[model samples]
Target: MNLTLRARRIAAIVLLGVAVTVTLLGVLLMIAAGTEDAAIEGHTGRADADVVSVTAGRTLVRFHTPDGGEHLPSVGVLYPDQLEEGQVVRVEYDTRNPDLVRVAGRGATLTILPVVTTLLAVWAVVSALVWWLRKPGPLHLRKLRPRRIAV
Candidate 1:
């Protein structure tokens, strides 16, 4: 095989690897969200939490338990969309582990869209790149041919 063909093969392999990695991450994300939801369902607690801060990844909240003890989940609340700092919002948490908290009425289902879309986007891009790399082209063939000269 020529250098171009070998290079294309390598690139396709790399893109396939990236797709596999992304798919695995998406699956893991779904599993984690499901697990957290399960934990909250098993031993549920309700509280009105004060949104301390909101970042792209997490929303920090401080809430008081039934016993009047204050708790703030270090990793922040799950499914905390549309919340702003200093806002009060209802939250559900694992009574046994108060640190495990999420926005009330929101569950693992909320994660499905983002994960599925991300996987679809990654696969689409990777498939296109791999196809472009592997597909045979007239231009590519022409480039491999030797130049002709008239004496």
Candidate 2:
């Protein structure tokens, strides 16, 4: 096979591999992000997240979840969000520990998975097809031999 063509084939394979790698990394990141302590099971809890105050780093949101029975949550510094005094929004909190809070339906981090897997699957199939198409020409060349000139 020609060196340039072989290099192209190798490059295509490498690109496919990179796509798979990135997809795997995204999956791992999602798993790590969802990790919570045994004491608190993060579950769906209906609560109000008021637009308290948007701060420098994160928007501080406040919401009340099912406490030991109910009542109110202690208003304090919540990281990742600067909250306003009052703004209504939906939120999810840990059932066991109401303190652990996160925005509902924001677990879309794994959404890139389908796109990455699709790209890799397409590349692998196309790579095989292209290599097969180019293979016949080389074989035909091998079949040809030096011929004597009829003088």
Candidate 3:
């Protein structure tokens, strides 16, 4: 095989490896989301929380438990979509672990669309790249023969 062809094959293999890793990570994210939802449902507590701040990754809130203790979950709320700063919203949390909270009515199912879309996008790009790399090129590029030298 020509050196260029070999290099292309190696690149394709590396990209396939990356795609597999990404897929695994996406699956793990879904599983983690489901686990959190189950935990919150098992020991559920409801509160009207004040949305302290909203960022791309998290929505910070402050809520008071029945015991008059206030909680500001360090990692923020789960499934915190469309929340705005200073807005009051209903939240469900784990009484056993106050830090585990989520926006009321939202569950792990919300994560399915985003995770599946990301995986599909990644695989689409990877498939295209691998196909281009593995496809045969011009006849001359397929193989290179070394010149014979008279001894």
Among these predictions, the greatest lDDT belongs to 3
lDDT of 1 by residue, 107-140 (tens): 9999999999999999999998887888777344
TM-score of each prediction = 0.88, 0.41, 0.88
Worst 10 residues of 1 by lDDT: 136-145
All candidates: CA RMSD (Å): 5.4, 9.5, 7.3
Off by over 4 Å in 2: 33-47, 52-60, 63-87, 94-100, 104-151
Residues 91-116 of candidate 3 have per-residue lDDT tens digits of 99999999999999999999999999
Q: In model 3, what are the clashing residue pairs, if there are any?
A: none
Ranking by lDDT: 3, 1, 2
Task: Give the Å shift of residue 71 in candidate 2.
Answer: 17
lDDT tens string, model 2, 2-47?
7867866776677667766766776665555546322223354657
Off by over 4 Å in 1: 137-151
| Cα lDDT, model 2, residue 71 | 20
Model 3 earns a TM-score of 0.88
Q: How accurate is candidate 3 locally (lDDT)?
A: 0.94
